[model samples]
Target: MPKQIEDQKKILLRVRKISGQVQAIERALIEQKNCDAILQQICAARGAMNGLMHELLEVHLKDTLVVNQSSEQERSEELQNISKILKSYLK
Candidate 1:
């Protein structure tokens, strides 16, 4: 609970920003914005989403594994699992 509360504000802010970006894309589509500009906006939105993902991963890693680490073996296993998750997520 403490771990979650730490980043809740920042995380919610990011979600709101992502929502705005999505809406902007919708508006651009309706206005028939230039092809290149629309593509750039889409790319920007993708970047924002990726940033949100990174923030989420950082929070999870710190709150779940780093904070609760009990032993070297557990730490190693959790790190491996997190690494695999990141690889799959990026893919």
Candidate 2:
């Protein structure tokens, strides 16, 4: 398969896994599970979300900075956009 398609599939799989984790959290809440267990699940889900974000950011950086042959101005714009996204993400 093409690299892009493969990457997309991997991303989708990660999304599904994260969804499952979220559902598990919901189920735990509904079942009135222990607070510690629920907190652990929330932490797990958060970690998974962070992993997904990191993967997506890496792909975006590679596409914008390394893979594409953009002009200097375009590159500068892309960097600004990435900076804006990172600022928002960190908050």
Q: Against the true structure, whose lDDT is highest?
A: 2
Query: What's model 2's overall lDDT?
Result: 0.88
User: Pairs clashing in candidate 1?
Assistant: none
Score candidate 1 by TM-score against the native: 0.79
| Alpha carbon lDDT at 64, candidate 1 | 74
Which sections of candidate 2 miss by over 4 Å?
1-3
- Tell me the number of clashing residue pairs for each predicted model: 0, 0
C-alpha TM-score for every candidate: 0.79, 0.92
Model 2, span 1-91: residue lDDT tens: 2137777787889899999999999999999999999999999999999999988888777777888889999999989998998999999
On residues 18-47, what C-alpha lDDT tens digit does candidate 1 reach at each position? 899889889999999998988988898899
Q: How close is candidate 2 to the true structure, as a TM-score?
A: 0.92
Query: What are the lDDT scores of the predictions, listed in order?
Result: 0.84, 0.88
Off by over 4 Å in 1: 69-77
Q: How many steric overlaps does candidate 2 have?
A: 0
